[model samples]
Target: MSLARFLIVLWVCLVSAALPLNAQQQTEQNQPMQLMDGPMDNMLPIEGQRFRIDADIEEITLLFFREPNSQPLILIKPDGSKWYDSDYPLERVTWYTDPNFDMIKIVDPEPGPWQVAGRVDKQNKAIIVSEVRFEAEPLPKQLFQNERLKVEGTLYNGTTPVSTARFRETVVLDVLFVSSNNPDFDNFGADPTRVAEFSDNGQGHDEQAGDGVFTGRFALDVVPGEYLPTYQLETPLYERSFEDEAVVVEHQPVTIDFQLAEERGADNGIEVSLDEKLVNPSSVAINGSVSYPNGEERRFSVTKIDSFPHVIPLDNLAYGKHLVELTVFATSNQGREFELQFNNLSFISVEPVAEPTAEELAQQARQEAVRKAELERQQREAEEQQLIVNLIIVAAVNVVLIAGAISFVWWRRRSKRLNNDPATAQKNAEKAEQKAQKKAQKKAAKSE
Candidate 1:
């Protein structure tokens, strides 16, 4: 091959080899990013209101020739703005055109459309335009209500009105019954059951004309007392969910009015009963012929039950004061419930009859004494058994010591007889003479 042709072919081959290596390097770079997995993969600035825009034109070749006369006025500016001054190419075939925007830019975008087009290596591509607009309105204020409250107001996007936005309205009633200090209700020697619950029985909502006003009314079940009503507004965006100051309602009917402001907080309607003052009598007895307004008058015989707060019909007492006494006797198995007639009988105290003696005090004392003596006898016997066990242990130890002394004396006499034997004396003398000779040899070796 010719030198120039061979050099060109070698360069082409080198470029081709590098392309695959470059592509492999790119794949390795993307692998680390792929290992990261989680919801972070689909993150956006305004996640709740975000939408994806996908427009792609696949690979195609495109070519353009430079014009000699036009000189490509790359730095031309159509308006006075710096963003429009073109100091770079419109776009490169192999690269992306990034349009990074700042917060202020998004808040007030430049007026006009941005026309964008792209081409592959040598082919012409279609063009598109994107018009940018900004929405700078502040969020509307939240709304709330309490039990039996009138909600009337209009919602606005800004100074401009937003009449078409869909809105949801809900009326919730929370009736709380508070108790007083009575044994039946509270934990500290008080009653927790003394409670009263007021309900919001009436509620209505209406949409007004022209002004975009919304209003609501609630009819509260007001008892003959005072109460506290709280208000709250709960919406998705607002965390505080606006709350209103406590509104007090007296014995008479109440009317409240307020204008809806965009920044105003909603009052959470918390229907709390006021701590009530009850007139408690010093003493009340359950002793009467129980008669309901409609049901039968339950009659009690001598055997009738006599439990505290023994609830029976009190003849459906009117809105006034009446006295009734019930008579119950421990002996008379048949108890009697009487509706005392105020006009006929005089009130009298019924003292209980003294119980007759069944056994003498002296007899009870003797019985107790017998039980005491029996307990003492059992304790003494247990102690004596323990003492006997200790005595037995002591006798066993003494016998062991005496047997050991006799064995020691016999061993001493036996040892003395062996030493007195003539044969034993001869053997001992021979051993002593041999030991002396060995000791003398060791001493002589030390001197040498």
Candidate 2:
């Protein structure tokens, strides 16, 4: 057979041998391994139920169901020891929950008999995911305000991407336009008409429906401002939203990377790398410095390096919030010398730059109080429901016990009366007289 045919035959044989084993394993894993099969209304600690872990496991996850959350999982080892996460040398287990989902992971579990203390739901509804990313290919960092703007995103589940299978049906992107010139800090005032609908239905530039990539684009004409993109996947299984903080829009689109690092036992300094694509390399004049709190502006050497990234270091900066701004002067191809200013580029060293104002702190406290009150209310309601169910069960058990006791007493009295009655005495007397005659006859025979 040819090489291709031989490989195909080998694959088929391997699959045929593994099919039953794979199916059985999957079925076992999917089933809810409960400690006991009964109503989990009382929230009582159940013992005596054991489950065996016969196979190697990389992770064991418990996903909770129903809103307001339910019981916490308690695990016990085969040697009658409580299993705590801290005991494991390398534990990747996590417990996280949201409004839509709750999940916990136990990493590298030992193989043996173990017991679960809490009841698990039948349906977990945790979404399957492999990876997700937002991308920008050949799009320039700097674009004119009147040009077209495009952005792309892709969502994945394991190796396969969920494109048109979800797309507008679940995955969505909402673009927020913020005016940088006179920005509104309270309400972002994003334009509803600028919302872009992305699709991967093999239309236009899309390669395939299930290829996982989604694209959206529109003209950048709503004044010169910063545009932030947010992506949302609202599904029954999982619901989450992510904002892309790396990309933004402005007339002089500039991106900066700042880090405070100390070298050779010296004080920390801010290292910055700047990139701008709109102007000619040799013609561009860029000047910037790190402004300190004590009215000190330390400058760094700027170069016209075009091929590789040029890093500039500003040293001996003290610990505090600092602002660094760049003023770019460039001659366009049309011989126009235009100067652009990027301001409020702030960074803090050792401490946060934007500390909460007094009023803001008060507002935060109020919100936290309200949130705690609501959580307590929900917990109380859950406890109330559980108590009611437990009370009903207890009442039923008491009734059964009382009925059993009454039946036992009545049966005891009836048994006594049946055994000691008038007919019983007469039968016993006749048996005794017969026994005496038999004994006398036996005695006479022995004498003869």
TM-score attained by model 1 = 0.26
lDDT of candidate 2 over 173-248, digit per residue (tens): 4444433333532224545235454566677656666566676564454444455445555433345555544233
Tens digits of per-residue lDDT for model 1, 125-162? 11111111112122112111112333444332323232
TM-score of every candidate: 0.26, 0.26
User: In lDDT terms, how accurate is model 1?
Assistant: 0.32
Runs of candidate 1 with Cα error greater than 4 angstroms are 1-153, 160-162, 165-378, 439-448
- How displaced is residue 348 in candidate 1, in Å? 41
**Clashes per candidate, residues 3 or more apart or on different chains:** 39, 0
Give the Å shift of residue 383 in candidate 1.
2.4
